[model samples]
Target: MRALVTGANGLLGSNLVRELITRGHEARAMVRRTSNVEGLAGLDTSMVYGDVRNIDELTRAAEGCDVIFHTAAVFSYWGYTREVMMETAKGGVTNALDAAKAAGSKRVVLTSSTAVFGGSDGPKVLDEHAALVEVGVPDYFASKAIQERVALEHAAKVGVELVVANPSLFVGSYDYRPSASLATITGYLGDPLKITYPGGVNIIHAGDVAIGHILLAERGEPNEHYVIAAENVTWREVHDTISELCGVPKPRIKVTRTPALAAASLMELAAKITRKAPLATRALAEQTGRYFWYSNAKIARLGFLPRSMRQTLTQTIAWLLVSPHLTNKQRAKLRPHDDVLQAMRQAQVAQRLKSVRIQDLS
Candidate 1:
């Protein structure tokens, strides 16, 4: 089998490329010129430069590929306007589908997200058949819903086999920059103050999600949607697990929605002033307040079973601890000793001062 993977440098795309190669498939990776290909190191695959929004580029990349895995999208919790989010999700998917059809691809595994389901106040495990709760979903969710609808409709009309995989929050090794979920967990780890949310997310390992895509490509039915989730856990439970694994103190501060929203507002203000991405934003606050539990029974029937959340977190934290990107100053912050924390604080201050100095020079 020949596979063309969009977003080949992203967390899920990188994993999909590796899995396809391991299964003896000729993989072609389509990535932007600026995308980081370090994660793809040592993989036997052809790298093609292309953007998801470019039709000609996508068509060129998809040529002669048997299967197309469309995983490219602008995924972020904050710092994007509604228009930017929608265009990336809907326009990007449309371009991929058109390119795949033009290139004569047999099947396409569209990488969707659980975000399409939206938030529900009622605490029930949402299956693929469950009604979509769209109120208050972020722009990203709205865009995904629109994109998937287009893909499914196109598949039905053209008789092109399309299988949609909706993965929940993913965590595992090779996180590279560490995705939104991993970053959130890392930010909260060992903190004396913790913010608790009424809602939770279904967590899965990135490797499992990647394998699920491969399985769907090989044996999945057309127009079928599979929810790829391992375990549904609350925010508190996730933080506790990370603390336990990392030997860090669990957060004691339990905040409500109002306070969280307020904090996110402040973060957004800071982000604008500093020209940096905010840790929390209005959309994030809205998402955090709603339960996102999902049922994976449909995919499980296809012999898909994922590891426990605890196991996934253990491996993820272990990887971060030894990662070259984690500076010694950051390690000291993780230490239990008070003196270590103070030293880490000083290092952070010095680092900020150095950045300001460099900017002044520039």
Candidate 2:
């Protein structure tokens, strides 16, 4: 079988291609023309160059493919208006599904995000049965919900089977860019995230999530959705693990949801006048202050087991520590907070002791 994956150079896209090749299927990767091709260098994949926002650009790329994995969407959270974010995200998915239908692709798997599931907090945890809540959700989350709605509606009209896979925050190696999740880990391990986050998160290895997509394509029910994720952990738990592993002292400062929201609101107002990104935006504060934990029992039923959070953190940090892909700025940002400070102090004391010893010997 031949499958086409959009956003081929991105975190999930790169891993999806690798997963497809391992399953004995031919993979076609659709990447933007200007993206750095280095991420896909060694992977054995047929490269298709096009923009998902344009249907004509994707028509030939989607031809003869049995399945289309629509993983391409604008995830821009900061410095983007709601209109721009939705237009970019919705247009991309619409074109991809249109291309799939026109090319006679039997199935198309849409990569939606668990961010679409919001405000589902209470006695029950969220799952496929959870409703899509847009009120108070970030533009990114609301846009994804709209994106899914449009794609499914279009798929139904075109006679192509559409299956949706909603993955939580991804963690694992092969994250050359040290994605948003990796960046968050580094911030905690390094300079010490001064403010405490209120909500918890579910993290899945990106490779596992990639394979989940293919499995969904094969066994997933038509027009049904699956939540692909691993462990559900709180922010404190994640930060504490990073501190223990990196041998750094955790920061003592903590900020609760109420104060954080007030601060973010003020910053949002300032950002509007400055036309610059805020230190804390209202949308970000609102989303992070809510629990995003999801149930993955549905995907696990398909025989896809994910790695433990411990293993995921270990491998992810190990790679980031030595990867040439990391900028000096990124590397410095990841240096453990107390470890470096202690090292400098110890060196200063040793220097003074050496001078005293030299005088005694004289």
| Tens-digit lDDT string for candidate 2 (83-115) | 987897778877887898889888989999988
What's the CA RMSD for each of the models?
A: 7.7, 11.6
Give the top-scoring candidate (lDDT): 1
lDDT, candidate 1, 106-131, per-residue tens? 98899988888875775668889865
**lDDT of the structure predicted as candidate 2:** 0.75
Candidate 1 segments whose C-alpha is farther than 4 A from its true place: 133-135, 190-192, 335-362
After superposition, the stretches of candidate 2 with alpha carbons farther than 4 Å from their true spots are 119-123, 262-279, 324-362
Q: Residue 291 error for model 2, in Å?
A: 1.5
Candidates in order, TM-scores: namely: 0.88, 0.84
TM-score attained by model 2 = 0.84
Q: Look at candidate 2 and give me any clashing residue pairs.
A: none
